[model samples]
Structure formats: C-alpha cells, structure tokens
Target: MTKCIRCQVDVADNHLNCPLCGIKLRESIKDTHVSYPEYPQIAKRKKLLVKVWTFVTISIIVFSLAINALTWKVKPIGWSPILSIAVFYIWFLGQDLYQKFNINLVAKTLWNNYLILTVFFLIVDNVTGYGKWSLNFVIPFLGIATGFIMTLWSVKNKSMWRDDIGYILLILGVNVLPFILFLLKAVDVLWPSIASLLYGVMTVVGIFIFSGRRLLYELQKRFHF
Candidate 1:
C-alpha cells in the first residue's frame, strides 16, 4: 500500500502516482509495478526497411521492363525480363526467407533454386521454343531433390519423423507425376520419368531401412489402420 503524503490517504493500488493526490509515489513503496522493455521503435524501423526494400525492388522491375520494351527483338526476346526476375528473387530471398534461421538452409536453397530455374526456363521456352525440358526435366528434378532432402531429414531425425512421416510421404507422392505424364503420352522422353520413378523407389527403400517400424506406425496413424 502506498500512502499519499499530501492527502494523508492510504492507497491500496500499485501505481507510480497517488490516485487522489496525483503526485509521484516514492520508489521505496511496496508492490512496484511490473516493468517491460520497449521494442516498438526497433520494430517500426524493421517495418520501414521492408517498405523501402519493396519500393526499391518494384522500381528496378519497372526499369527492367522499360528496357525490355525498347529492346524487343527476335531470337533473344529481350533478356531484361530475366534480369527483373533475378533481382526480384534475390530481394525475396534476402528480405523474406533469409531470417528463417531454424529451417534447413541447404534444403531451402535447393528448393528455391529449383523453382526459380523452372520459372526462368518457362520464360525462355515461351520466348524461343518449348523443348519440353521445363515440364519434363525441371519439375521432376525439383520433386526428386525435395524428396531426397525429406528422406534424409527423416532418417537423420527418426525420433521426430516417427510422428511426422505421414506429411513427408504425402508430399513425396508428387514424384509419381512424371510417370503419369509419360503414361498420358504428354512427354516423348521416358528417361526423365524413369528417373523420377527410380527416385521414388529409392526413397521408399530408404524409409524402410532407416525409419523401419516407425514408418509403419506413422502409416497406421495416417490411415487410421
């Protein structure tokens, strides 16, 4: 309880000032209020930086598009758009996902590179000619790389993966896409699809060897079997 010297009032609340006297309370008063460090200024600065980076990146994209418009031609199809994409990708990496320190950086980089390259190839194919590489090789390889990483993660951290294996298995099911593409006669080359099939098989074998009984546990949990 804080006693107001001026009003001779005994206050029962915890505050820096007297309720009736409206004067500063003594530091020796019991039951001091809880203190918390202020971080709003730092948070505001971070937000400001994000806004600045967004503006700068958008400006660069506009400039690249202007250049591309001026240099539109045959065969090359003006490479400025590629430059813009690259710049945007870098900005996203630096500003958005770079601070995610807990995630596996190597796996993140591989997946990001796979998607970015796939997009770049799609653009190039659209401008020049569609060789089916982006749809055939690029997408399938992305799945292969991601599956490999997920398998390694599960094997390396079996104790955790014991409970989380179902999601990983479901995601790895994308590797079946290439084989489906082949069966639909969507792709003339079978080697890429065969490679994806081989990757899927390897992953399954790895899960059996490394995950073992845990894999069965996760499967049962997933399927309610």
Candidate 2:
C-alpha cells in the first residue's frame, strides 16, 4: 500500500488515485514527492496575506471616518471615497467569511460582485456629480489586477482557477464596454435603461454558468452520488 499525500489515507498498491480523497497517487515510489513542510508554508503565506488585507481594510475605514469628521462642514458629496471604502470592507469581510466557513464558491461570487459594483458605482457617481478623482479609476484597475494575481495564485496552488478567469473576463467586459459606448454616443442611439438591463442579465448569466460548473465538479468529486 502507498499513502495519499493530501489526505494521508493508504491506498491499494494497484490504485492510481485515492478512493476516499480523489488524490492522484504515484504509479511507482520512484516519483519525487513534495515534503510535508511545503504544505504548511503555503498555508502560512495565505494566512499572512489575509492578515495584511484585514489591517489595510481597517485602516481605510478609520481614516475615512476621521476625514469625514474633520470636514463635516465641507463634505463634497463624499460618495466616491465612501464607496471605495465600502468596497474594500466588503471584499475583506467576504474573504474572512469564506476562510472561516470554507465556502470557496460563495466567497468568490461575492468578491466578483463587489468588484463590478464598485466600478459601476464609481462611474455613475462621478459622471452624475461632475466629479473626477484618481482613486475612482484606481479601484477598478486594482480589482482587475488583483483578480488576475489571485487567479495565478490559485493555479500555482493546484486549486480551481477557471471560475476566476471567467470572473476577470466578465469584469473587464463590464468596465470597458461602457466607455466604448459612451465614446460613440451610443447612449443617444440606444436606450440607457434597456442597455443597463441587458448588462445585468449578461453578468448574471456569466456567473451562473461558471459557478454552476464548479459546483457540479465539486459535487462529483466529493460525493459521486
């Protein structure tokens, strides 16, 4: 018998994968194996990132509150920064909940939703209020960049990255397509309300398709029933 590296379960000598855990088993003992310590190291790095992001989120909230308090009399439609802070807080909280509950799919869905909502809110707020800020642009840009980084990390860790890739594409399309339409003055040619409705439908469809696939794969792998 040989041991499954992931679940530590013993498998029959002739088995190619662990029956209980679905972990791939070596055909022969001659295959080089990763050390146990490496698993802990990866976990440690993930924990550290979580801590750092939490700290950054808290700092943003505190700083925003302080600024709002100091400039209460001169508040300039404070929605931009407020929305940015809200986005960061939601992202952080979603990640924490996912880690605590091991609800990876829910966490990913919330993360993607918050990211796209942040961009839409920022653009609408800025355009309607005739205000522009560098940070407004920064939030969405960072969202896409960080999404890509997380996808790459997931791939390296042997986790599911397909859902992430789909999310990144969806966000990119949502954020960029609006600008193209605006440049062409397509809003005058097309009804804004109808366009918005179609966009919402597309976003929901994309999430459903990608998330459904991941759910099916997980159920089959874990229960096979």
Candidate 3:
C-alpha cells in the first residue's frame, strides 16, 4: 500500500496517484499499472487551444488600444481596458472550467474570481471619473465574502483539515490585505478594513484554540519552519 501525504490515506499498489486529492505517492510502484487507457492527444489539443486563444485575445487587446489611441480626443471613454478585462475573464473562466473537471480546485477558482472582479471594478471605477467605490466598499467586502466561502468549504471537507491549513493561511492573508490597504490610504473606509481584519483574526484564533498541537505540527510541516 502506498500512502498519500496530503489526504493521509493508503492507496492501492496499482494506483500511482491518490484517489482523493490526486497527489503522487512516494512509494508508488513503477511496474504496477492500471488498466485505464491514456489520452495524451486530448491534453495536447487542450494546450494548443489555450495558446491559440491567448494569442488571439492579446491581438484583440492591441488592436482595440491602437484604435482607442487614434480616437483619443473624440472618444476618451477608456473602453479598451474594459474590453481587455472582459476578454481575459472569458479566457480565465474557460481554463478554470476545464481544470475543475479533473480536480477540486474551488479555492483557486475563488481566488481567481476575487482578482478578476477587483481589477474589473477598479477599472470601471476609474473609468467612471474616479468614483472610489471599488476601494472604499467593494474590495473589502469581496475579501470578507471570499474568506467566508473558503471557511465554509473547509468546514464541508472536515476530513481534510490538516491538508486545508495552507488555504486557511492564504485566506487569512487575503483578509488582512484590507487593513494594509487602509494603512496605505488606498481604501477610504475604516469600518470595512477593521471588519475584515477582525474576521481573519478571529478565524485564526479559533483554529489555534481548537486545534492545539496538531495545528502546530501541520504548520511546521507545511511551512518548513
């Protein structure tokens, strides 16, 4: 039997990867193999599609920017950035949907959404005559919502708490970002930043108080500190 380090489960000798989280086992046998057929060509086609799509999107962005620059005096609406953001979002969302079919990458999807929406709104805010709504309210609330969703996800997968500490730490950092932004005077609202910071602090404190020594061990193993 081969043991999966992430899920802490024993895998059969015939399986090279863990059934749960798909991590490779250290003691995986080279000669032992499954009866499933491989599809290398499908993966290659996917990669080719991604490359082609990226090139096409970048070309579109360049063309739009060139046109916008030529008509700067007549139409200075800053529409190119919004168009570029939309194109990038479609590409990223497509990639996420493709990967999510194979792996449980919901946390990564949430992080991607957070980044895309934050940037999208910031661009929109700037384009709309510096409304300041994105930094003042939207981003901090978005971070809080993301952290909440991630927390619920960890709870739903209670069996994988040890494996989940990394995500928790990452979300905690996300929660703390609003405070940093406030300190830098980037975010005008103090209440939202304080709320996000307090939420993150409470989550970390709850984990430490409840987990005790196991949390320490997991932290040490994950961070190598």
Q: Considering every candidate listed, which one attains the maximal TM-score?
A: 3
- The number of clashing residue pairs in each candidate reads 0, 0, 0
Model 3, range 1-225, lDDT digits (tens) per residue? 988889988888888788899887654455667798776898888878878888998899899889988999998789999888988898889876763353346666777788998999899899889877888888888988987887788768773354456766787888888889889988788998898899899988987888868888887887799
The Cα local distance difference test for each model comes to 0.71, 0.57, 0.81
Candidate 2 accuracy as lDDT: 0.57
Cα lDDT for residue 61, model 2? 69
Worst 10 residues of 2 by lDDT: 186-195
- Give TM per candidate: 0.63, 0.35, 0.71
Q: What are the candidates' C-alpha RMSDs?
A: 6.5, 16.3, 15.7
lDDT string for model 1 (1-225, tens) is 878889898887567788876898766445567789886797677778878888999999998888778766643476776777788788777775533344434444545665676687777665556787776787778778776776576457653454446545654676778889889987778888889888888777877886689778767777899
Candidate 3: worst-modelled 10 consecutive residues by lDDT: 98-107
Q: Report the alpha-carbon TM-score of model 1 versus the true structure.
A: 0.63
Best by lDDT: 3
User: Which candidate, 1 or 3, has the higher TM-score?
Assistant: 3
| Model 2 spans with C-alpha error above 4 angstroms | 1-39, 74-80, 86-111, 114-190, 196-225
Residue 217, model 3: Cα distance from true site in angstroms: 1.3
RMSD of 3: 15.7
